[model samples]
Target: MHEMSIAEGILDVALDTLRQHDASVIHSVQLDLGLMSGVEPDSLLFCWEAVTKGTAAEGSRIEINTIPIEGKCLDCDKTFPVENYKFICPYCDSHFVQTIGGRELQVTSMDID
Candidate 1:
């Protein structure tokens, strides 16, 4: 699955950062994952163990912070949380809504030795 590739890329970055900082061990890798990012957390977790096997990040914890989707309605100028991936404005019932957040998929931090 694509999650395996994503896990591989994450491990690559973590390994590169560890080398760049002269750190030999990684305690944990933290990620900011948004609801609309299209990356499945369960799949990523399942692939993480396989990808980190025998690597410097082996046995390291994988921490994911889930971000909720937030959007702003153009008609009413009201900002609200998006539910069920619906873009409809809650206050104005308008379809013209702009996404303000919940599209992120990035590594935020790492606990290293």
Candidate 2:
């Protein structure tokens, strides 16, 4: 699954950073996850435990900071939540909407030992 790959990548980066500093453990990881990123929190949580089973990140807390789905309406000049992934602007009934946020997946920080 893609979540596995994502978890692996996160672990890889954490491991690399720890190795550089000769650190032996990772206490926590902070992640910024967006609603539009199409990631299931439960799935990611499950993968985190499995991926970190034997690594320095084992037992590390995965903190997910969720980002809201925001969009800018082209016709109404208003910004609102993108419900159901629809691009239509509710106020103006226009289909032209620019996504303003909520499509991000990134590692915000890590607590290393």
For candidate 2, write residues 64-83 as lDDT tens digits.
99998899998889998888
lDDT by candidate, in order shown? 0.94, 0.91
Task: Give per-model TM-scores.
Answer: 0.91, 0.85
lDDT per residue as tens, model 1, 1-113: 99899899999999999999999999999999999888999999989989998999889988999999999999999999999999999898999999999988889999999
Model 2 root mean square deviation, Cα atoms? 1.9
Q: How much does candidate 1 score in TM-score?
A: 0.91
lDDT value, residue 31 of candidate 2: 93
Once fitted onto the true fold, the runs of candidate 2 whose alpha carbons sit more than 4 angstroms away are 83-86
Q: Which stretches of model 1 miss by more than 4 angstroms?
A: none
Whole-model lDDT, model 2: 0.91
lDDT score, candidate 1, position 2: 91
